[model samples]
Target: MLNEEQAIEARATLEELHVEHRDLDLVIDHLLLSPPPDELLVRRLKKRKLLLKDRINQLESALEPDVKA
Candidate 1:
């Protein structure tokens, strides 16, 4: 089980990651709508989106305390 401080930090980190995810979504939308989309920029945005998803999973896991079977 996480202590109070650890739990608080984890929650804060999760919030920050969620905000980042939203920002990435906006960027992706903009790129998709561009008349002459930059393939390289699109690729980079996709990669970052994947990374943020993984980070979100990790954060959620951290927020969950161990449960005995």
Candidate 2:
């Protein structure tokens, strides 16, 4: 189980990552609609989206403190 400070930090980090995910989603949507999308831009967006997803998962896991077996 996490202490109070640790839990707070985890929650804050999770919120930040969630916000970043939302921003990335918007960028992806815009890129999808744009005609003749730039290859580099598309690649960057995909990479960022993947990274954000991993980070979000990590943060979410941290937020859920596990009970000791």
Candidate 3:
């Protein structure tokens, strides 16, 4: 379990990651629509975005409570 300071830090990190992910989405969309898109760069960006999503989910789960039946 995270302490108060650690939780705050985690939340901040999560927010930063979210912003980065959103920015990546825009860049990827632009790259796809532009003439002669860079397929390799887009693929790499997509992979990085997925990795960020996973990390965000992990942090969110840790910061929240779990419900039991």
Candidate 4:
């Protein structure tokens, strides 16, 4: 049960992460377009992107209201 301030902070963090994820997407696309892209660097970036996705999901779930059956 997060307070209003905590919820606001969490939302802000989520927005920041979303922006970073989008930025990473652009970078990955650019990397793919160029010939002889660094395989290792791309792999690392992809891994980081996945981690950000997981964190985003977590925060989203946390922000959702709990449901009771």
TM-scores, one per candidate: 0.88, 0.80, 0.94, 0.96
Q: Write the residue-wise lDDT of candidate 2 on 1-69 in tens digits.
A: 677899888888888878887887888778878987677987898898889889878877777868689
Which ranges of candidate 1 are over 4 A from the true structure?
none
Residue-wise C-alpha lDDT for candidate 4, range 28-65, written one tens digit per residue: 88998899898888999999999999999999998999
The parts of candidate 4 lying over 4 Å away from their true place are none
Q: Rank order by TM-score, top first?
A: 4, 3, 1, 2
Compared with the true structure, all predictions reach lDDT values of 0.87, 0.82, 0.96, 0.93
lDDT of 4 at 18: 99
For model 3, the superposed segments whose C-alpha errors exceed 4 Å read none
Best by lDDT: 3
Query: In candidate 2, which residue pairs clash?
Result: none
Model 3 residue 50 lDDT score: 100
lDDT of 3 at 68: 81
Residue 27 CA displacement from its true place in model 4, Å:
0.2
Q: Report the alpha-carbon TM-score of model 2 versus the true structure.
A: 0.80
The whole-model C-alpha lDDT of candidate 3 against the native structure comes to: 0.96
**Residue pairs in clash, model 4:** none
Per-residue lDDT of 1-69 in model 3, one digit per residue for the tens?
788999999999999999999999999999999989999999999999999999999999999867688
Query: Model 4: which ten-residue window has the lowest total lDDT?
Result: 32-41
